[model samples]
Target: MRERAVSGHPDRPGRTPGVTLPSVTERKGTTNESGVRAERQGTAGRLPALAHESPATAFGDYRAAFHSARLPMALLDGDGLIIAANPAFGELLGTDPGRLTSAAAADLADLGSDPRLWTAYREVLCGRSDRLRCTRRLKHPAGQTLWVEVGVEPLPGGERFLLTVADSSDRHDLLARVRHLQMHDPVTRLPNRALFFERLSSALEAASFEPSGTGRIGLCYLDLDGFKAVNDTLGHRVGDRLLSAVAQRLSRCAERTGGRGGDASRGHLVARLGGDEFALLVENSAGTDQVAELAQCALDALQQPFDLAGQRLSVSASIGVVERTAAGTTATGLMQAADTTLYWAKEDGKARWTLFDPERNAHRMTRQALSSTLRPAVDRGEFTLEYQPLVGLGNGRAEGVEALVRWRHPQFGTLAPNRFIALAEENGSIVELGRWVLEAACRQARAWQLERPAARPLFVSVNVAVRQVWDSDLVADVAGILAATELPPELLQLELTESAVMGSAGRPLQALQALSDMGVRIAIDDFGTGYSNLAYLSRLPVSVLKLDGTFVSGFRSQEHPNPADETIVEALVSLAHRLGLTVTAECVESAEQAARLRRIGCDTGQGWLYARPLPPERITALLDADGRTDDF
Candidate 1:
């Protein structure tokens, strides 16, 4: 086939027969011949007329341009069959121009491999679309992969299409190199955070859409334990070398676990997510066990010492493993869970692996929620006191009652002191909560005293946190509460844990002595459990010793009574008597335990044996029933 050329008709002045070429007067909408002449004169330099040339001469010039032009060009018939090809087009595919005739244009560059592009190519040939343009990867006969931009446009008469190809291999290679640098860590030479999250998101998306997938994803997030110490002692140069070595080992571990069935394509992705932190992502994880195995392998690998520049240093890592279904999962959520589990590993003493536990996480979240709401709860009056009776061992009369605080949390229901006391102390909110307890207990004790003006009044003992003394004016708080309630100072006993009062030489000791001098009693709570310093007891003005529950729990069974526990209790009680301090046994669950405590000369007892901590109404009922009831 010969190259097609544009020709003019003999009847028309300067237009082709089948092709319509609008005259300048028509295009500019100028009816006057003078205006048309002026418009044509303005564009005369940019547009040159070829209508005067013969058809044979125009054909010759077209054939020369097609054969010698640098741009790759081809002519395709309406059926997509290559009718003619230029030398540049032949060189682009590394073939002879003569051998390309009658070949499908889509088959030459493998453009038909993609259904969309193939359909678009056929659309242009059939005149359904004006043009089709896309980039395609083609293999040359010389064993080279070439990236080319393929463009198809309809020719005159719309029966044939002109196909052009532009080599874009250099641009593609440059972009790929830039992407590699952007998505990798400089020091570790591993994938950086950007690539890690990208792959994670893609894997989740694939798992969601692909039915043949495992439907699960996994991650092992870890960091070097005690890594900062190395960076502090040694210089960062050594630190960096150590991190690189750790990254290499982690990469090997990931590869080993990922290639389980001899498939390298199924391998995991190891990435350096900044500093000593690293992550290994499993695209199609089997289950938690698979992820855990990967974590264990990483831990074992890092347990070995790294030799960096002649300095041998031992290091370890803590790993958090998470594996679950890809449904309803997101990259951010997975990363958050992995981070929390990693913290748990470090908290569990480091150098170990921890799996994500929903229960444990929920507990932590509950603690955080409770901590944040503590001070507000106090202001909202969520806390109330429950009284546990302290009975005299000699007459079995209710001598006093220990005030245990309970939180009537609206959302969590009733919470005991064990749940939120430590949180309050840590946040320095215990001072306020402790003050509330003191005033409330004193007021309630005053109420009880008014109820029974004739009976011996029950003293109310309130537990004092160490921070309450350090963070607040305990002496003034107590004195004000006692004066306001008109309850005698002696009737309000303050209890401090043994640890808090053991080395009490500073403000704590001063506060205790000042409270003691004001005629208020001081009791050492949980005496036997902490710092059992019997000699140190003489220095403080503590008047009561509350033995811990462990000592009383041993005296439960009469036949198989713990002789050692009994001897210890008796010795301590005797010692307390000598020191002018009364002994109160705690956690007396049964009558047998209570009887044994009484026999041991325990001055007072507080436990379930007498009564569990009860509401004020129930205690009033007990007081109304009898002056001093044994049990409710």
Candidate 2:
């Protein structure tokens, strides 16, 4: 086909007045290496043309294609001013195609809104970058927001650039819906655990970067008390309704408390953390007072009865409140503190809120550290025995000694038995510890007996935990320790707390009987403090009763004496004597207390009045001093 030659505009330079362009089919079949190479070079490649087409006809075809294309397209000059915009581009902005010409391309699509995007856009227009692509949110002239992806590419000539936009609102909306479902709890319609943590982390990060705010964060972690009972009694469907109602109340509480100090914009985030637990996060918290107010509001909200699925139910909640400066706080650390505080609230009694206490938490952490290291401490031989003199009140002489166990901890220094004895029992380490005490005390008693061949040997009394009787072979252990130490069974006294020895049966009963039959003396320490079952004492092989300190504390007063204490002691002594059991008074701090105890027919006394607990060498010195003179 013969094509007409077209004339170019007289105003535009670098164009021939009459030029003929090639046909599209002829350009495609041309074996020109430069054309193929240009096509491979990318968007900046030279434009292919028809062999016999005029410049006007080619330009008209190009304009037709550009206007009819679905993608929004625009042509920008070197100055970033839109020289031409296709119909599709004008429709995207809800404007006329003619009106868009000569406008700044950056201003039309908000390309220069962000500094980074603006820099890249300038780079592409200046031929420094091949292309620039970014997603932008634009406000259309029609009062609608459009999310579009804008692409800027260098034109075939270095002096111009081609800008195209693709509408991404549908894809963005779909993604938003999917994210909303994933981040929310279906039942309560609140943010779930994943979303809560994400927001908390983001808030913390923002606080770190922006130091202008309060720089403090707060959280209220709460659990619904007796919610499990509700789920068990009623169906899970009813329980879910109750949870939704609780969520609504909590949301209202957060809303009410958020308006304080004009912080409604940074309101608390109420989230359901699975099951009956929920969390309220406060970013840029003013102080602990704000957090506390939120917690109290939540408590008050949940206190009202919830009518769920025709079931009227009442439930209380326990909350842990934690507020601290965000500078040193982490999501994990904050959550842990909140969890511990919640436990404290439960322990302090439900239906209340407790703030995080550092001192109490430190003590608990120390206790945990001690518990974890206890069994190993025993193997390391960190325990030692100290002996307190047990004197015969009638003779005024040290008849025996009560063996007290102390832990020479490496980190915590010397710790008394009360600090770790109960911990040992709870972790089942008491059996091992009790065995060590038994063996050590027995060996010491034998050493004392061997040291003093002529004088009366001091019997060693060792404390026994009730767990040892049930958890270990107490009878066999006692016999083995005596045989190993070569200590006479008669010289070893085993002391058990009154409560531990009461209601003895099963293994404990059998162990006590076998030990007594083996000639080991059995003594009940802290006699009157426990069951005080004077009747059951006869059935057991109890050889001695150490009066509790409370009964003996009455003897501390001289000017105003407690006659009732003395009378009670006298009666108990008379009854014990008839049962062939000797009575020992504990905590006899003064001579008057000792004299009164002696006058009441008490056979022995153990207290600071005689001597505080001493090491082995000190006990040996006391024995030597007593042996040389009768002044003891």
Candidate 3:
């Protein structure tokens, strides 16, 4: 067999007709014009042009190419012996070329023990395949595994085979790093939302296929209470450090609570869902009991002060726990429920955990629906006001009417002000709603006044939320509504809660005084229900005090009335009278209650005893009865 000096194609006797391959010397540099070495190192030794036709020269070229191919190369005989091996293969195996030659390829890489690799090798050696390529692990004496792409090409005679190996360790390492980043949070090195969702979805899917009551999932969604305030006050650097410390504690919680009893997938997975919110996904949950215990563990873990930049900062967490069989549940549904329950924990007070309650959640959803509908309802005229008469206790005459706002919710029938007012205030819709109520009350009052020329004009009192006073142009709104409705200032009373008036010493105080100067009376509604700050009560320009209904409830048992409540009411009445302020008692449901209020010197009473809050037409009808004195 002649080994020709093949300068072009390795399989051909001479250079390809007309096509030229770069000579060994020319191709020594990289594939690109860059000075960097080519990924494949060119054959080490090159034959001179004068020796191109000799058989021995061809053998030298072939031998040089075999040793110089940068990718590890080897040749094997029919018996699976390593007949020849390149320096690269020796370097890859950490052995000398001479040692590699006598050593079987399988022995060098421990591939013979793997049945799959041995089968593929036997198939190639028996001429059943021309070539085979696959990834295999190389066992090093240092107890390390090296990944390599191994390719076997059968020789023309089938008695010999050539093997080429390319180390894939670096590529595999790069891929592993990429995968880690994708699943983990960089700051805390915790599983991120993406990875958490993937796990949750997989668990749920597996649960769906299993029998009922087999697989269950639990999730504890946690939010750091007062974390935003800390971030704003302490700067983001400290906040970040605090978050890292919190993450460490939460991870410890996961490890401690996830006892060894469940399947491979059944474990605690604590992940950061972003910001100060983190979640723990529990697989094969034993029930709410286990979930609750885990949540408590997390709460206890976070109770310790975080040491950040030498500052020990106290922190608390609110956790929402949801546990259910994975059969019909979903990742999105679980997360949503957990979030809602977390809000319940916050509302119930921080540093605790709350389990999901369907009934409570339904009520909250209804409230949220109402809050969202408020602004549109206002614009759509879905709100109406009913007036409850404030009757004079001495003469049984209608003294004033408290204007109460009601929502004519299309789905839920008519709702009282208490149902949605707080939500409105929270979402800043109260300002507009307040303005609307003021104008409606004033218009109704003016209409009643005009209808009864012989009767005294009844003053209309409209409840003003604290937010309305602070966030809205209350003074200007009152003035404009008064002028628009032609209602006299004295006939319009603005009722603020006791807390609202007690805290009004700055701009709010100035606004109240300005309204009072305009002759629109300012009254403290629901008095004695709040802080009941008597010291500052006399300093305000308030003209009326509507005692909260809690005070009037004591008057029910006249035989043995609650003396403390009676005394409190009496003192409130005396104080208001001393300040020249009118006193009105709320919730005088019984005649005896009204009479007791009268005896206590309460100038006015408002409750079911006088009348439930009536629509404007009903009140107008009452105003026409006997010059309005017999209406009550």
Candidate 4:
């Protein structure tokens, strides 16, 4: 191949293309109309773009055109020599462009000191490819490194190559930001679900190859207890502030306990699973006890309420901790088990910890599997209704029976509400369950009215979960149920707990009012179980207040010493009466308790002693006897 000399200037040009003029040219004396070659090296102000000029005046216009290019450029010869260099190139390499001539482009690049540069150059010179681009940092004279991306193209005639360089420091920074956003949660800046799984999977692989005796991975799934209470009490804006603060605490704990400070085997990853659920993935755990200890640390850390947006808000977590040698079980199975155990923690009591047990996990799995069938169970007629009689406090006469929901499982025989009501609430199947209870109880009340139509105008009290009240068409469902059973609104009462209406803002309050307006009596069931603000009661359209079983049961228990129970009950009774509210006392087991309740001014009562919740037939027989039973 032939080498072409890059001389576009002609009028004052001292050299011709491929002339190979002698190094010093005693003839030209290193000076001409082109301008005196300085005793020391110097370059014109800017690098020019020669290829864009017309060849006719190319030689005359080269110098002007060369001053406009932004990128540093240089021309390289076949012998790896820098044939010509621009001012920008001189500034980039920290050298005078004139002195750079006859120096190899590799020498000017400063990468010539590295072995890799030689290998890349060798390949480029061999015509393996015409272009080369790479990102590499080179030492500069300023005691700093300059990051650059270079593009090299084979110039026509095969002798010279054009090199263009750009500084990519800013671009590199943007790339880092892009990666972080992809791997972290936008709101909390914690590792997202994607990154957590990646780290977990890697840890698992390492655990498989390592000896079993070494250690294992620990997973702790923590869900914020009563987070919904906070959201319902405050608002989502405050809830978000609380969540961010929680993320900070969790991240700090994860960093402190993940592993050895300087080792990869001890890394921990913490992530938010959306909403109020957060998870921690721990590596290199010694045993179950160690995992439990870590869980305790987490719980203690959350004991201090988070101070956010000027509010001292308390946050507690129910954590399900699981530690396995990563030998027997897989990650998915382990997480599922941990999650199952977490529910047990919440079920046992909020703000607690529970370790995964296979037996408990199996039971929870069965329960979860059964929950999906509950909605369909309603349609299939697998439900039954039982009524417990509500007797008058003074007369001991059965007033009306409260409706209780029971599910008959083909396999489990019969399931109680406590068994599946939580599940139904979680899966939103409670809407159907509530409606069924309504219809069943209303019909039973109608039947009782048929036998004794004037017997105190018997009313059926049906318990409605807060979820149902918030989810279903409450007024419509109750109205339809009563109309269908030919029962009046007064004959079918809806029992709502105090907490259900305490912070009753938004649609829930409106729903309650709508049901109340339909002439259906609304009662606050389990009044004192939830620490409700009693002032809200005066504003509610409630007709009855059922003293919670706990308050009434404490009246006679020797273990508890509280005369306030009776005082509070009497005061509530007085308040109920003053506010035109009837009082229904629950858990009336003994004749003494019933008599005491009546003495305290209770209008109605229900318990095992008042003819336990019986089948429809038992209820009918009682009504037929017309309160003439020998037991009564």
Candidate 5:
């Protein structure tokens, strides 16, 4: 079989016409030296018999093959005008084959001046590259959008170029749909976490390479307040509807604030991270001021009531806004900071936005780390005990010591009880921690007893939390610890907060009475801080009342004396003594306050005036020195 001879159209005089070749292999990956030759042969063909036959007959055969070929093919002149086109190319442009001839190849669709297309066209026209293949969006005259893969190759015998287009509408559409599903939330229809991270990373990358003004970025991470309660009561259907509504409002807000075209960083992109959490990424942001305005807008939009499931429900959100230059920031760092700030908003009382503060976040992170490490710290014996002397007001002698628990944290050094006690309680680890303190205190007290057998037995008081009283076998634990340490019950006092004792009713009340009857003295710690039930106090077997530090603080300015505080303290002491309960004034920071407490008939005084908290060896030394001083 002779190879098909390609010829140019006679009407378009100096142009080379293209031959129709057989179907060839689809080009995948990239084009190389051999691939370019194959592309020209596959789409245009050889013009071998052009020099052998007459122009008219050769042109006739070329025209016959051009018209007969199944693919959409157009033959362009040196000036990029389509001198001739196969019927398939004409059909693709929604025109007749005769009408398409001599029209500018670009004028067939809206892409005549597209830079990307023209750039490749220039490269082929100027002999810089062999062939150009690109995917373009073309609008057909038949009122349908078409995605076409175009191939531009230099004609073999003239200054003309060959342009072949293959319909890629189905493949492009399928790919686009897959991308949309992956990047979007099905219910809310907002960008999901994956796309948000992608865009954020892209923006950060661009900012890193750009100049100063374009380098700043911002993010606002938000969570709906009380969404769990709504979901639990109304069902998931209503919750989903509520989420959709929120998404719509957020989208509108982003659209209103978003910048157009290439000013992408000045634009807002809202996304749903999952569940009730949502985030907004702001590119090329004007610092936190811009982000703050966006957060306020989001809050206002969510403030409106949602009509879901025939009920009018209103919800508020907590937002954490972060803004910084992209030079040293990362997607993970920004998100973690946003998460931490958002939690601060929830903790500081929700329904508002909070800005990121490094100091506060560090403190919170430390607390969180401590909370997570509490049980393990206990297991590792990282906690130790310190004793504060409880001196008798009459004799100025250290009668007993209150055992305070401290964490010998490897990183933070020794931490006081105030730093981590509430954290322990909140995480339900206080019961175990309290038991450890009790056993340790008992063992220490027995050590002191054996060290000093002649002097009066100095009692040790251990504070117990309300959780420990109710959650554990308090009486049994105390019994076992005492039996193990060989510490007498009378020599170990259990200090319960005023709220703990006053709030005790059924089982807690029983537990307190059982321990009190077992010869464990019960003292009300921080007496006036809570609701002090005077009448209820008589019903319990209470041995002592620890006056709150507030009244002791008043005694510090006794020169310009607060007569009312004096009257209150005096009255409290008189009333407690009448009920057969000893009164111990706490936080006695001055000799004057100590003298005032003694004058007011208070039994014991505990504070910095006597001594700050000390280790066991220091307490023993203080006791020995006091004994030697009494001899003097």
Candidate 6:
């Protein structure tokens, strides 16, 4: 068939009026070297062709030249009428190509009133640009809408234009995949830290600026206690699986509270902050009591043991919570405050929840500064260990020396254990510091043995912080320090508080037993201050009980009056002797108190009366003054 040449429009007066050749669609990922494929018969046609059939006929050759033209194509008249289109257009829109008629520019692609697309098209139509590109939503009759990138351009004289639309289906799919990976944790597929913060920021803003709302947010920062043990004792694979299970359980916590409150927009979010630390963000929350309820909910959810790879693992968390308006607040402050509050939870004892208090936060800030400075202080030689001799009441000779920590701050002068031990434990520096103290004290004991060669070596007792035992490798660490110092374990004593020993159930007790079995002695320090289970005291392998300083401090009277206090001390001495444990009275500040303790048959005593705690050098001098040399 002889094709009529494509025509130009009246807008260009001097141009030839006949039809011009049909245009070819650009093909991607195709070898168009061959004259088009038979299947791509008529997908392209000249934009200004006024005769539809001729344009359609010419398009077949254009389509043959570009076989991979996947996007739909169309031609529009000066009035924006659908003049001619290819079969691909109908297939893409799920409509008949022949049935589409030209209408207003807005009517054709449903540009409607959205100026983003309309303005771009008008600019191209007025000959301001040769081409226009835009991303748009095309609503389908089947109720499915697609994201598309449409390119449109004007022909000469502005009589017609070419429109090409690419199905952004693949790009959209790829974006969805990328977004999922970006927002979710690959291990658990739970929303990660970035996404959680994004949501939290938005929630804070909404609560802050949204009118007529109370603007409250509840946050629960939870750290899984004993989680490190699972990783160290088992393996990381098991730990990873446990974290995944934890995420699932936490998700259930968020969902349990997410209910429609007559309006559908408010709820809570749960996210994993990092290893072993997770959080729940509740938006527009109630006050502290309600937040506490949420915490209780989470605790209840975590109460059940996790089944990870054929092993049943148990863990509990310490939660710190705060719920209030986001007014004048920042994301960083919120998280830092939450973390600080969590430290308090752990400090007060784990497996519990504590509400955030500004006063508590101030204390935390001070402690944090102290904790950071502790490591450097050791190198600066700021710490000194003081040994208060424990004298055997029967022989008037030293039986042991209790090593206590003291710091000589350049500005603050001498600061005792009360000032730094808790801070050190919080920051985990206590493990190393405690080891250093142990080694130093044991070496001092060896020195004391050398000086008093004729006398038996006095046992050296060192205090152990509970965190050092829980978080660090207690058994191996103690054993390593003993081996390193070449100090006999029999001469070292590990002193712990009564409360620390009470709740070990089975595990901590097993650990303590391990240390004791290796020949080290165990003593319950500050014995009567805590709820001392005397029933279990005998069962413990402890060798000594130092009565709390409070009991002895109150035992004295202004005159020779408190015989009742002396009688009570006598009863304790009898009770301890019956249990095969030596009882030592602490803070025996006066000769009168020392005489009373001795008269009561107390086995051994530690007090200022026996000579205040001194440095290792002083302790050595004292041993030498006793005038014996390695003669034991």
Residue 30 miss distance in model 6 (angstroms): 45
Report the lDDT tens digits of candidate 3 across residue range 1-632. Answer: 32212111122222111111122233343243321123223322222112234545644657777778888887765545455678898788776665554344555544455566666666676676677787766665456778888888876545557888888999988987898899888887788888888888987887767675358889999999999988899999899888888888888888888632111144788888899999888877889999999899999999988878888899999999999878779788898999999999999988899999999989988988998888999999999999888888988878788899999999999999889999999999999899999999999999988888787778999999888878888999999999999899999999998888896778899999999999989899889888888887778989999899988999997787898988988988998898899999989899899888899899998888778888888887777663243445
CA-only RMSD, every prediction: 10.1, 9.4, 12.0, 14.3, 8.6, 13.3
lDDT of each: 0.81, 0.82, 0.79, 0.73, 0.80, 0.72
- The whole-model C-alpha lDDT of candidate 6 against the native structure comes to 0.72
Answer with 1 or 2, whichever has the higher TM-score: 2
lDDT for model 4 comes to: 0.73
Return the candidate ranking by TM-score, descending.
2, 1, 5, 3, 4, 6
Better of 5 and 6 by lDDT: 5
Q: Which residue runs of candidate 2 sit more than 4 Å off their true CA positions?
A: 1-65, 75-83, 101-104, 115-133, 152-162, 259-265, 627-632
TM of each candidate vs. truth: 0.83, 0.85, 0.69, 0.53, 0.76, 0.49
The global Cα lDDT (0 to 1) of model 3 is 0.79
**Pairing residues by index, what is the TM-score of model 2?**
0.85
**Candidate 1 lDDT over residue span 1-632, tens digit each:** 32221111111222111111122232234223224234333433122122345545644647777788899987765556555678898788776665665555766655565666666665666567899889877777677788888898987666557889888999999997898889888888888899888888888999989999899999999989999999999999999999889888888887788632111234688888998899988888889889999999999999998889999999999999999999999999999999999999999999999999999999999999999999999999999999999988788778888899999999999999999999999999999999999999999999998988877788889999999999999999988988899999889899999999998888999999999999999999998888887778889898999999998888979888889999999999999999988999998888888888888799888877788899998777767655466557
Model 5 — TM-score against the truth?
0.76
User: Poorest 10 consecutive residues of model 3 by lDDT?
Assistant: 12-21
Model 5 misplacement above 4 A? 1-46, 49-67, 72-146, 150-165, 177-189, 227-249, 255-266, 274-276, 304-314, 627-632
Against the true structure, candidate 1 reaches a TM-score of: 0.83
